[model samples]
Target: MRLEEIARRLGLEAAVAGKGMAAEVTGGYCSDLLSDVMANAKEGYVWVTIQTHQNVVAVAGLTSVAGVVIAGGHRPDEETIARAGHEGVTILLTPMSGFEVAGRVHALLSQTS
Candidate 1:
């Protein structure tokens, strides 16, 4: 599924609105630890986390994630938003918890598969 579709299906709002909306979302990974995500998140996976920092955009770029979903109604700071936009990493916002977002993403991916 595409990042835009995931946003639509999950009722997510764009925080940075990067240019990766057309990117394919192969999977989803939920984590707060940056190191864990860097090591484990697959390419094209929409990452679900509460860490709303510029470093999150850097890590997402390194891992080539489809996007970063800020769960629990969190919003990225200005620096994070700038970095995400510069790096072309889509940042999505949601009011749901990370677990809820993960479940929905998994269900959608499963349906597509």
Candidate 2:
């Protein structure tokens, strides 16, 4: 599934979508720990996290994930948003919890698979 489709289907707000809207959603990763995501998140995966720090953008860039979903209605800081835009990292926001986001993402990917 495409990032655009996933965002639309999930009703995720494109908080900082400078680019990468067409990125593929190969899978999903849910974690609030940056190191865990850096170690395990794969390319094109949708990361579900509550972290709103700028380092989230850095890790997203490093992991090459399709997008980072700030769950539980948490919004990234201004600096983080700017960093995400500058890095072309698609930052999605949602009121759902990380568990809900992960389940929805899994269901979406499973359907496509």
Task: Give Cα distance to truth, residue 102, candidate 1, Å.
Answer: 0.7
Supply the global lDDT for candidate 2. 0.90
Strongest candidate by TM-score: 2
Off by over 4 Å in 1: none
**Each candidate: RMSD to true structure?**
0.9, 0.8
Specify the poorest-scoring 10-residue window by lDDT in model 2.
16-25
Which whole-number lDDT from 0 to 100 does residue 13 have in model 2?
95
Q: Which pairs clash in the backbone of model 2?
A: none
Off by over 4 Å in 2: none
Residue 14 lDDT in candidate 2 = 98
- The global C-alpha lDDT for each of the candidates, from Candidate 1 onward, is 0.90, 0.90
Model 2 Cα lDDT, one tens digit per residue, 1-113 = 89899899989999988466798788888999999999999998889999999999999999899899999999899999999988899999999999998898899889999
